[model samples]
Target: MAIISIANLLASYKSPESKDMWERICKSIGSQMENLPTLEGMRKIVTLSYNHLHYYLKGCIMYLSIFPEDYIITKKRLLKRWIAEGLVAEIRGLTLMEAAEAYYNELLSRNMIARADDPKWTVETCQVHDMVLEVMVSKSLEANFVSLVGGSYEGMSYGSIRRLSIHGGEVVSEGSRSNKIATSHGRKNDIQVMNMEHVRSLSMFGPEDNMKMLDRLGELRLLRVLDLE
Candidate 1:
């Protein structure tokens, strides 16, 4: 029999919709309001906050969903990829990376992503909370902004590859299994897999040795970002 007031709820939630909903509920209760917030109520607040974000910021956040949960995201790499994907807009005589960095800081202020410890004070890394990652992944899939290959992360059915990301060593073909190698690089060679011509951004995690699949990296002509780390 915990008693909670509309004012207290308002203080706890930032979304105006949540505040209004509580106000109406409180009025109906005639000062007898005393109920815990439901999961759905919390979801609505989060949804409201997401829907109200600037389109640019929304894209930035959704792009983050491509990474695995709790992944230590490097701000430098993220900014570079965003710029390469043409997701960042140049502003006020600032470079694309500079502008993108501003957007990153803004997301930090909004609590959409958490900063990681940086002894150098560069704030070069960050991570999305588990709940926030779920929301972003859902929205990204709905918009077909990104497609996840094989991974432990939740994603929809495979579709035409636009921005492709493979977690773990899944994308890499082990030693003899992927004997076929394209010798375009003349270094180690790359794997000849399915058509990746349409893919714009490619992110691969796990061992670097597995990266020698496609003989040369230039084969992905449309590729804007090639994140191997």
Candidate 2:
């Protein structure tokens, strides 16, 4: 399945020679198969696919990092969030929603995300593969695109949090005697004092007990998206 997906992705390059393109695609498949045994290798292939995405599509897909693994995201909801974040731009002949739909379709065609199976979900709804989500999280961190707290991201620190996603965990403030805070997973995470003045979006997922984190909302003077689920 991964091989076929990679082939489809490479085909988008539109080289003049079909035979040459097929040969390159075959080589890429073989390379990916060889590296499939290692997580790092899988990430490399996912990164390769991601690097080929359109610039706008790149940001739109990376935004998926904010979602928890296996979350069923409605197409309409996703598109609206993209528009809210200003990730969707006005195209020559399309409205913002239409352009956003195009971005979603492009990602689907490239096999970057998968359609959700629930009958209740609309045909356009989709979810990211766990592997793809991992790559997105890594890329989002590398670019400082989003600051993810809790879960496996505990103890992580960033210079300036442009966007924040709290995945059901607690963050200890600097005033505390202990820098470590207990996460939902029963792990102690070393929290840090970060600059949130530039934060444009914040999403929190978990129990109301975590509402204590909202005390810092006053610092986010530039916040645009505040989602609590």
What do the candidate models score in CA lDDT, each in turn? 0.63, 0.75
- Candidate 1 worst ten-residue window by lDDT: 177-186
Cα error of candidate 2 at position 140, Å: 0.8
TM-scores vs. true structure, each candidate: 0.66, 0.81
Query: Which pairs clash in model 2?
Result: none
lDDT of 1 at 145: 85
Give per-model CA RMSD: 10.3, 6.1
For every model shown, the clashing-pair count is: 7, 0
lDDT of 2: 0.75
- Tens digits of per-residue lDDT, candidate 1, 34-132, equal 232664344444444566567898999999878976788888888888888888987988988889999988777667778888675565799887667
Question: Where is model 2 more than 4 Å wrong at Cα?
Answer: 15-29, 35-39, 120-124, 169-192
Q: What residue runs in model 1 are displaced by over 4 Å at the alpha carbon? A: 1-41, 118-123, 153-156, 169-195, 208-219
Candidate 2 structure quality by residue, lDDT tens digits, 42-100: 66678878876779899999999998768888888889999999999899999999999
